[model samples]
Target: MQKTSYLKELVIKNTHEKNGANNSKKETEKIQSLLNLFSIANPNSGTGTSIDGDFGPATEKAVKNFQKIKNAAQTGVVNQNLFDLLALPIKKAFEDPIQGSNLRELIVNTAKNHLQNNPFELIIHQQGNSGPWVRSYMDGKEGSDWLWCMGFVQTIIDQASSIQGKNFKSLMPLTYSCDTVGVKGIEKHLLTRYQAARSNPSVIKPGDIFLIQKSNLDWMHTGIVIDVNGDTIETIEGNTNSMGSSNGNAVANKIRNFKTSKIDFFSIAPLV
Candidate 1:
């Protein structure tokens, strides 16, 4: 059978239904993964069920809600249609069918597109010069005067993940603080320290994040990696300029030398 078909069969076989037999731990885990992804995509669809591998009333409700959204039968069961909907975004995002092209490549492509388009526009605000794009980084929570470098990076990652029906918060912490991202990386064991990444530059690839360190425990600036070459790295940064600064006026493309720069690198964990 085709891989996708086989996978669908596996999910259906293992799924826990409202009135059906309880699913095995493994089966329930798979279902929970899909539920988590769905919740991230549709926050109000009752799909935000806890991913504890227990297909209880909440999971059933979430399934039913998702079914309604898809215009399918509200069976509250993991059926082929449900599986297909869960997988559609990823399949659509990577339809090019290139071998070994992973989600990171998709993220890099998205960031590159933003850089090429320069979607942000400078506007005078009560706080300072801001724009719609900058506000979007904060999900419209913070104003223009806010330090939004980390928000910009987080927004790009979140947007890219959304395109593939994945959750950015599941992959990385959704924070506006660069230091918070660095701390979360260390706590989650997802961090590649600056010195190590500099010594072994191969670890710094496109879609990775670079944090400009202000002190031993503080990061003042952030950016997304678009390309990495020997000794030099290309980045798309927010609130930066021709001469880079964490509090610069707008988003701009930048190049920095890893060996000579005081930057820490955080490698984003791959989506399951």
Candidate 2:
């Protein structure tokens, strides 16, 4: 789909079903006003904060750091000018991917690049009376060009042939933590990516899964950890964009940022 169409659908999702509300419009206006606020690029360097308003963990840390810089009691709060400057997001966060030639980077790039091209853009395909092969949806619902979690995982499998392909034909998705739904012939509806990372938070590698929340209780979203710097870890995922935004590409959508604080609502680890 074109970027414009993608963005239109996203705005609808992010803004909620209701068209116009005072508070909603105001909030949207605020977010649009800034990207990064009150924090230097290297926030941990102790050089103060950057004024960007993306509101990931860095801004939160920057706020705390700024408080420490001024010795202003020790509250992790951002006020007025500082609030306007540092009113960052707690729901999402993104840090630069750690670069390397090591196994982690190799796997991350393999996964990231592959998914970036088409995460959930797989078409179910359609057949027309004119005897033409057409792109169609599974029950003629949600349309022909739509992708869900299964497609998201499959795309990665096609791309990361070396890492998981040879060992396992396909990954089994599960649901409610008690079922089993392997890719080829499985049934667990909720096996998520987050469980993979949580099991080994101390040493999360590139291919680990990062489970995020959906309407149900079990993990519903997934992502791959691309980099793991000293304190920052960058991930690429789908359906877990949290908010509907232009930055997201739906399934093969662009990865969005989130803070550990934000994902606290759901398990945000790899489901190994």
Could you say which candidate leads in TM-score? 1
lDDT of 1 by residue, 65-128 (tens): 8888888888888855577676554333323222225667866776666554343324333444
The TM-scores, one per candidate, come to 0.60, 0.35
Error of 2 at 173 (Å): 5.7
Candidate 2, residues 206-237: lDDT per residue as tens digits?
A: 55444444433434445556654443456665
Off by over 4 Å in 2: 1-106, 115-147, 162-165, 170-200, 214-217, 230-232, 239-248, 251-272
Q: Model 1's lDDT to the true fold?
A: 0.67
What lDDT score belongs to each candidate, Candidate 1 first? Answer: 0.67, 0.34
Where does candidate 1 clash, by residue pair? none
Cα-lDDT of candidate 2: 0.34
Off by over 4 Å in 1: 1-100, 121-126, 142-144
